[model samples]
Target: MDTIFYNVMMKSLRNGKQWEVLEELAMEMIEKGIQLDNVSYSTIITCAKRCNFFDKAIEWFERMYRTGLMPDEVTYSAILDVYAKLGKTEEVLSLYDRARADGWEPDAVTFSVLGKMYGEIGDYDGIQYVLQEMRGIGIKPNLIVYNTLLEAMGKAGKPGLARSLFDEMIRSGLQPNVITLTALIKIYGKARWARDAFELWEEIKSNNWPVDFILYNTLLSMCADLGREEEAEKLFDDMKKSELCKPDSWSYTAMLNIYCNGGEVEKAHELFREMLGSGNKLNVMSFTCLIQCYGRAKRFDDVVEVFNIMVERGVRPDDRLCGCLLSVLTFSKNGEFGSVLICLEKANRRLVHFIDILDKEEATLDMVKEKFREILNESVVEVRRPYCNCLIDICCNRGLTKRAHELLYLGNLFGLYSNLNTKTEMEWSLNLRSLSVGAAFTAFEEWLRALIEGIEHNERLPTCFAIHTGVGGRKLSQGLADSLSLHLKKMGSPFQQSEERAGWFVAAREEVVLWVRSLDSKSLLATA
Candidate 1:
């Protein structure tokens, strides 16, 4: 009678009426007083799960425990699957822990779920851990378990290791499926190990294996990456000839991507046109591939045209695309000045999100070299002095210090980027003492120390003339750090001084030390 009722509940589950079936079973159990066991409780739990009624499944599972019926491995496996599918990995693991703590070892299906979840995050070790535990428990793995493990290893770029596992599975009398072979193709392609992909591709074909569209699509994308256009075309032809599969938009996009990347944009455009007639909607990524081809060919005008086409098709341009277009235009040899200016203005408009009104003056510099030398001599970018000092500070650090200094004074005369430094005065450099000889030496030492420490830790600090001189100023604190640290020790230590000079040097160092100690390092770097 229990068997008959179980079959009836299974039928309701198959027909998608788990809740109604559970309701009928509860009434039957109540009126007939049928002896409830783990199987009976699990049957209702499985039904509740079918309707995504996890709350009811837990409630009935508790009832089963109360009736002295413990859940077996299969019952726990079912619950784990439901949680995993809902992307509640935390809950899935929690349930697994509870089932195991209660002394129920997970079955093959449970191992499969846990293996797949870890695989999603590139955790190949987790899959192996599960597999080893299964073997230790004397439970042999099914083909699904091994296939998933092989795919995870392949996707993680251990194709050679994955192939070894494939052979092991064969030795264990299990055959790897299409999913395993396709993953091998991807790994080989990713590593530019085309020979491996070709060998595996041939093996899949020679075995008369039933291949899916995904398997061919992966190979096509791999061939594109490998610049194997000849082979990619042959595969595309074979895909068309195969009666079992149809060409997908992804396959077409792969071919077009390869052609465009191979300096054959015309072919890519031609194929893109052909695909439209076949009723395929070119997704944003595929369209992006085509646009990149135009950018590569330096036909940037055509890139604009294609962008318009995208807009016409109701495909909105994303921020990354906008940024790429701006970068390309900035580097264009003969870009229209008006257009470039328009883009700069637009980009600046967008920069309001990350910029303060005072930050827009970052480009200004208007002091003459005579004026600049006077300020350095005096040790400050004084009130109403041109921003020429900051630019001079930055460019000189980049091996163009003299040129940067010349440009800063020249720009000051002409008022280019002159408004830059006027927006905000940095707080740290504000009250710094005069640029004494001793103060210069101390900051220079800090720069060199930072470099040694950076190299010791395998880190890097930007060293430029503009960088050094910029921090050397009294306003912003970091100009000196950029200059000497990045340069090959332009500033030198006066080790040749005699003991008589030592007293004076020590006295001077103490005074300079007092000045820098009063400044904030955080605000120094922030403004710098």
Candidate 2:
């Protein structure tokens, strides 16, 4: 309840009004276990702004986030309106940019605010740009944007360009109502071009369309321009007397121009009053027309008075505003290069970082951390080839060494002979594959011979070849058939000692043991 009292006081400060103590108590009584919904939070932000509590509203929005509540469309719309009214358009656009990052889409009212602001600044190009964006997204332009574009372009003297827009609207199946047609007529009338203006009038007439005062006024102006003054007066009288429509600003401006040109200055001045009195609050264009007329008639003082009135009504001259007092004079870069070079530098640093990782052989959790950092850096690298080369080197180098002498021992245990030359040649050539297999058998037999010799050198085991032999499971004596032939071949090791110098398993693996053999006399006689 005490906290509720503080909140009510804050609300009062926001609204520029006072709160009752009992109302705070009642609000606290209504507080429930449910924290707050998005709707209630959004409403609070909106109400804060309506009370002119901008900072309070922003603070509340932040608090809502901390409290896990989301603000919705109405909340943002109220804030946008406040910004527009305060002329803080830049801040308004910046917030929207941030909102996009947060994934919140601004609705149409926001776009409408932007459209109106652009229209006020006379950014005719901006109008088209907004239209293009809206159309690309399939957003239907509402009356405010559509009509404001027409008025802005019409005043800017681009009615011919705006005609294509009319066809587009019609193609969208919207009828050109009286308001739309009137804007078109005034656009053509301001340019004093009768072709499209009168054509649209005749199109309306032939289609049995209801012609309003704007149609008749534009038609009368066309007549006066073509020297059909009598017809112009007839149409003016008819439109002003009609029960359905009366002569408005367009009519009076046209008629006054006619009278003033015939040197009927008094009648023209009367018509001007009647025009202003009849809900035709003169705009800047109205006064501009009057100034042109007076200057043509050589009424310098009247032109000055009208110009003064134009400024007094806060209609300070637009581009067409300057008269004689006239004029004053007024008077990312390389962003792609910067962006591309920054990307290149980042990529180069990434390659260096990867090379460092390959150089470090220590393994632990820190290695995993380095690996993940490399992944992230590569994501930032934006270059593929250098990153690929770094990875290939890292994997190949790590494959070459894991621990001290570990590769050689592990290779022997697996019978793989982890020699890089063996692996590479085996991988690249079929002939090397056969050699690799033969080499494995050779190493195994050599290892077996070494084991047997080492045991015999210690005299721990006897040779079984002479002690007990078997011929298909029966004991047998030694054979004596080739004893003499072996003696001769062994002595020829003396005759062929020069040839024995040549390699033939060194030729003495058999010769030295054979020469040491005693010649069996029984075998010599058997040979004879």
Winner by TM-score: 1
> All models: lDDT?
0.58, 0.49
RMSD of each: 15.0, 38.3
Cα distance off (Å), candidate 2, residue 363: 99
lDDT of 1 by residue, 290-351 (tens): 76677656676666667666667776555444444433343344434244324334433432
Clashes of 2: 0
Clashing pairs in 2: none
For model 2, where is the 10-residue window of minimal lDDT?
324-333
Q: On residues 203-263, what C-alpha lDDT tens digit does candidate 2 reach at each position?
A: 7767666677666766776665544455567777778778877877667777765664454
Stretches off by above 4 angstroms in model 2 are 1-36, 41-70, 105-107, 152-161, 185-194, 204-235, 248-254, 262-528
Measured against the true structure, the TM-scores of the candidates, in listed sequence, are 0.57, 0.39
User: How does residue 523 of candidate 1 score in lDDT?
Assistant: 45
* Best by the lDDT measure: 1
Span of 10 residues, lowest total lDDT, candidate 1: 423-432
